[model samples]
Target: MKIIIISYQKILFQGNIISIIAPGYCGYFQILKNHAPLISILKNGFLKLELESEKKKIKIKGGFLQVKKNMVIIIL
Candidate 1:
């Protein structure tokens, strides 16, 4: 799946990934390819992604997450 992370300053990340771990309002959630669609609030935490053999992590100030059409759009 593809993941995009955006912040008010700029677009933080855009790439293909196997999974993502982010802080949700209720708790932390992991998103994987072909995961069910969802829209949830985010909390301050790290946004972790798996790209092939690489694992990337970025800090997010908390925002929102939307999953659809095999895409994960994170606003933080």
Candidate 2:
């Protein structure tokens, strides 16, 4: 799946990922490839991206997360 992370300052990341470990309002949540669409409130924590080429992680204060049409968009 395609992952896109954005913020008021800049576009942080865009890549193909196998999974994502996100900090949601309730708790940490994992999103995998071919997962169902979802919308969730985020919380202050690290966003981990697992890709075929590399595994990356970023710290974020908070953001909105949306998964739709095999695309994941995170706006902070």
Candidate 3:
């Protein structure tokens, strides 16, 4: 899946991933390839991205996320 993360400052990240774990408002949630369309309010925590060779994590104070057609857009 593809993901783009943008903030007021600039685009934080844009990449392909095997999976992602996001800090949801209620708790934390994981989105893998072929996830259903969704929109959620995020919380102060980290977004963990599992890439081809390694894993990465991005810290977010808060944001909104949308997933559709295997694409993820995150706005902060």
Per-residue C-alpha lDDT of model 1 across residues 17-66, encoded as one tens digit per residue: 99988899888889888888899999888888888999988887889999
> Which one is best on TM-score?
3
* Global lDDT scores for all candidate models: 0.88, 0.93, 0.96
Error of 2 at 20 (Å): 0.2
Residues 1-76, model 3: lDDT tens digits: 9999999989999989999999999999999989999999999999999999999989999999999999999999
RMSD of 1: 0.9
Clashes found in each candidate (C-alpha, N, C closer than 3 A): 0, 0, 0
Query: Which candidate comes out best when scored by lDDT?
Result: 3
How far residue 26's Cα lies from its native spot in candidate 1, in Å, is: 1.4
Off by over 4 Å in 1: none
RMSD of 3: 0.5
Per-residue error for 12 in candidate 2, Å, reads 0.4
- Estimated TM-score for each candidate: 0.93, 0.95, 0.97
Error of 2 at 23 (Å): 0.5
Worst 10 residues of 2 by lDDT: 48-57
